[model samples]
Target: MGVSGCGKSTVGEELAKQLGVPFAEGDKLHPASNVKKMAAGTPLNDDDRWPWLDLVGADLRKGYEADGIVISCSALKKIYRERLRESCGGPLAFVYLEGSVDLLTERMGARTGHFMPLSLLQNQLATMEVPTGEPGVVTVNIDASPEEIVANALKGLASL
Candidate 1:
């Protein structure tokens, strides 16, 4: 999981394919009001996020019996990550896609037919608390090809 334009959806999809697991894009679960706010270029506050985050957490918990599942989400803070672990009640690995603001802006700008605007990206970056010290997290710098990032993530998972 990572911020907008960090390629969470893209990488998660590919990673799920590699692991042969189901993939859920957390953005799809956002309430329409949140989507409208984002579509209108307003960044959502924490108050607006809790319910949706909990929903994503619940979904993660639902697949506990499976080999694994991969999902794309903007888990930007330690609190958010904790909520995820609290739901899953076990160690889970996360591949954080990291990149520069310039890169992310460019990438977000290139995309089309999405509600998240480039304007909201900076707020996400500002809100992001990189999970360097978090348990069960593998941060993958996203500047490389998706293949390379996915390979590194798979290798990291092996060690855990």
Candidate 2:
């Protein structure tokens, strides 16, 4: 889990492919209205995201029924992570990608075709709860390329 523009989708996809798990991009589950809000450069409040989180959680639970799954989501806060864990029916191991605000802004500026705006980035970072010593979590720095990020996550996840 990470802030938007932190390579969650890119890194998550690479990690999932390597782990041979079903990969789900959390953005695909957003409601049209939420997408619209994001496209208009508005950050979503928890109210705007709960339903969306529930939908992604459903996919994760369903995917778990078949096999291990990897998901790309901005599980930004402790509460948000809790929601996802509940939705998936228990605990979840996650790789938290972290980067500087400036780096994310640069990435966001370079990104095309995404609904989330660079403006909402500060809000995301503000809401973010770092992993700390949290169990079932591995925090990864975001400076590396997607391949390297996934590789580091894999190494960490294996230790978990």
Candidate 3:
């Protein structure tokens, strides 16, 4: 998990396909109010995020009980990750998609139809607590092509 435009959905979907597991877009689980807030270019506070994180974690747990699942979540803070872990009540692996601000902004600018605006990218980056040294997390650089990024993620996850 990483900031917006870090390609979490793209990578997570490919990773799930490769692993023969279900894939869920965490953004889709967001409450309408949360979406409305973000769509209005307002950054969400922790209060707005906890319930959404719980929903994401619950979905992860459901897929875990079946055949494992890959989900794309911002998971921007250590506390947020912990919450997800608690809710999942099982193993959770995060593929942190790392990229430069310019790269991220460029990608965000190029995308459309997403509720998250490019204006919020800075806020997300500022709020993020990078998952470095965190257990069950793999840091994958996003400067490379999606195929390469996914390949590197697979390699890192294998070692995890």
Instruction: Score candidate 3 by TM-score against the native.
Output: 0.98
Q: Candidate 3's error at 82, in angstroms? A: 0.5
Question: Which lDDT tens digits does candidate 3 get at residues 1-160?
Answer: 9999999999999999999998999999999999999999999999999999999999988988887999999999999999998878688899999999999999999999999999999999999999999999999999999999999999999998
Q: How are the candidates ranked when ordered by lDDT, highest leading?
A: 3, 2, 1
Residue pairs in collision within model 3: none
Tell me the TM-score of each prediction against the true structure: 0.95, 0.95, 0.98
Candidate 2: residue 83 lDDT (0-100): 74
3-59, model 1: which lDDT tens digit per residue? 898888888898899888999999998999999999999999998899998888888
Question: By the lDDT metric, which is better: model 1 or model 2?
Answer: 2
Write candidate 2's Cα lDDT for 1-160 as tens digits. Answer: 8999999888888888898888999999999999999889888999999999999889888877777789999988788887778788655789999898888899999999888888888888888889778778998999988888888899999898
lDDT of 2: 0.88
Candidate 2 has what TM-score?
0.95
**How many steric overlaps are in each model, in order?**
0, 0, 0
lDDT of each: 0.86, 0.88, 0.95
- State each model's C-alpha RMSD to the native: 1.1, 1.1, 0.7
